[model samples]
Target: MKNYTITVNGNVYDVTVEESTGAAAPAAVSAPSPVKKEAAPAPKKAAATGAEGSVKVTAPMPGKILGVKVSAGQAVKKGEVLVVLEAMKMENEIIAPSDGTVASIHAAVGDSVEAGATLATLN
Candidate 1:
């Protein structure tokens, strides 16, 4: 008998394969295979800060910066487009979290950033 372990999507399972001799019957095992429980997802990290008095806005996921709709010191309304990020082959808009002036932009067009990396700041 041969035993093997396989893991997929954080879940692990143990399997056993029995060998049969030529023209002979296979043996049966009574013990059940062991299985490891799946692990839970990790918690998300918080956003990074910018300059003083500015509310930092971070990327929700890793992506390429596609467009920047606002500039530093520009006043933006709540839910206004601040940047466009391309992730998973789709464009995602990064909107302003609240009504405030764009204090600064930490990323530019065509830049790639990691999740929770600061994208901009609103004051």
Candidate 2:
């Protein structure tokens, strides 16, 4: 099977197709395609406060933290990864909520976190 993304009316659709073979045909053929709807977009991250203030970092999805990139008191960029979470056999890096100092870490490596769970705090 093969997958592809098609755009129609300015909207994107994911489609999968299966290949077919026959003895009489010199070449392969493809079956009818199937379209799969993708999940809705995730909520937007909270606005960044450049000044001194606590920024709540939330998990993007349910997953286990495979690695931690920032420690408390460490300075970070606006989109720096503070943790890496493994979900659906894929590792996803959790970025900092804002450009500031790492105030605290709520979840540690090997810890499982649900979507929207507090992962860290930034100053």
Candidate 3:
């Protein structure tokens, strides 16, 4: 038998696994107790206009919005950080794809967003 530690988000779990020599099926391991989760509210309306020629900045992964670095009408350069996201206990920065004006911000700080969710637009 061997023991291991696994972390999800910030929670750590102790797990044990046994080695088998024969072809018999291994013992079943009971899953951890399910944590009660509050239902997520419906997504708030995005305030950005989907104007022609605008580029959408999307979330790369599901995470909570940590910070918004630009506002509508704010000028941004390529490679500038546009938003900060916290996923799996790590901070990820989303940057502008090209030099342009921020058309709108669809997410606010503390909002939980999904992967591919539009965060903002640039034009």
Candidate 4:
């Protein structure tokens, strides 16, 4: 049996290995203890009401808002890009549900959003 001390990303770990003479059996490895993490601060609420209109444009997946293409009170067409979200290393466009005026923008650039969360409201 041999023991080794390893450090990864400033985390220390202890490893043990057994020598085998004949049969090739899989060696058991124990993972390092999990590091303690601080809880994230709660997100602030948007100043304007998110539910501003009858039609809602929502995020398709969890991601960060890369850009907001439309502003409040702006007229938009169906399939027009309302917001650009970056998720899983890909950019996804959140489009208007129908031709209408943008009543409100619930997300801003660099804001993290969840799937199905409202991005904009159309009137």
Candidate 5:
């Protein structure tokens, strides 16, 4: 028999495994009840500079902003890359919706964003 201790989300548990000489399955071990603890509230993000524009550019999936390709007031064409988002170990280009100037960039490089969260805007 072998014993192991593991911690998950700050909760600790003991696990045991039994060696089998044959093909039979090992017995399951029940862990002790975990203590209930209150989780801390999430921190809020500060508002970005400039007001949001008429056309919103949002994230398709939750990811970290890898790069900001355009700055405020920069002219862009339809389908131009505005930001590079890293999700699922892949880089996705967030593009502009139409030919317009970049109104504002709500998210910066390295900022963690949720799906449908605003990354930038065009006007």
Candidate 6:
């Protein structure tokens, strides 16, 4: 029997190896236990809702919509916050791209959105 220390992907582990002189039969390996399978989650939609010619505000990444700051028909500035998103346990503020009236809000609180998914529109 021999023991060795191995480092894999920056993780260190201790391993033991047994040497055989070809005098004994190999040990049998038991069948692996059945694994539990889980149903696939529904696909995420990147749908954007707005009137034609309206500026679309999109999410930067996949996350839950934490809050909608501006309502429909509200006037906002170019750098004003439009929505709050919760991602990776952090809160992200979605800002407006230009000064405009909020034409419509497509995302609600607690809604999950994908990257580049429009959350609102401005006109």
Question: What TM-score does prediction 1 earn?
Answer: 0.58
Q: Tens digits of per-residue lDDT for model 1 on 13-118?
A: 7878787776666587755555966656765443333454358889999999999898777889999999999999999999999999887788878788999988
TM-score of 2: 0.56
Q: Which residue ranges in model 6 land beyond 4 Å of their true spot?
A: 1-53
TM-score against native, each model: 0.58, 0.56, 0.61, 0.64, 0.65, 0.59
Please rank every candidate by TM-score, starting with the best: 5, 4, 3, 6, 1, 2
What lDDT does model 3 reach?
Answer: 0.83
Whole-model lDDT, candidate 4? 0.83
Off by over 4 Å in 5: 1-41
Where model 4 places Cα greater than 4 Å from the true spot, the runs are: 1-41, 49-51
Which should have the higher lDDT, number 5 or number 6? 5
Steric clashes per prediction: 0, 0, 0, 0, 0, 0
Candidate 3 local Cα displacement, residue 66, angstroms: 0.4
Give the lDDT of residue 6 in candidate 2: 76
Which residue pairs does candidate 3 place in steric collision?
none
Per-residue lDDT tens digits of candidate 6, residues 3-85? 66655444455656667678778744343333344334556754444453269889999999989898887899999999999
RMSD of each: 7.7, 10.8, 9.8, 7.1, 5.0, 11.0
| Cα lDDT of model 3 by residue, 55-92, tens digit | 99999999999999888888999999999999999999
Candidate 3 residue-wise lDDT at 101: 92
Q: Candidate 2 residues 1-123, lDDT tens each?
A: 788787554456666766656566554455434355555576554432233337888888899889988877889999898899999999898897578888777776777779998888887
lDDT agreement with native, every candidate: 0.82, 0.75, 0.83, 0.83, 0.86, 0.80
Alpha-carbon runs more than 4 Å astray in model 3: 1-43, 49-53
Better of 3 and 4 by TM-score: 4
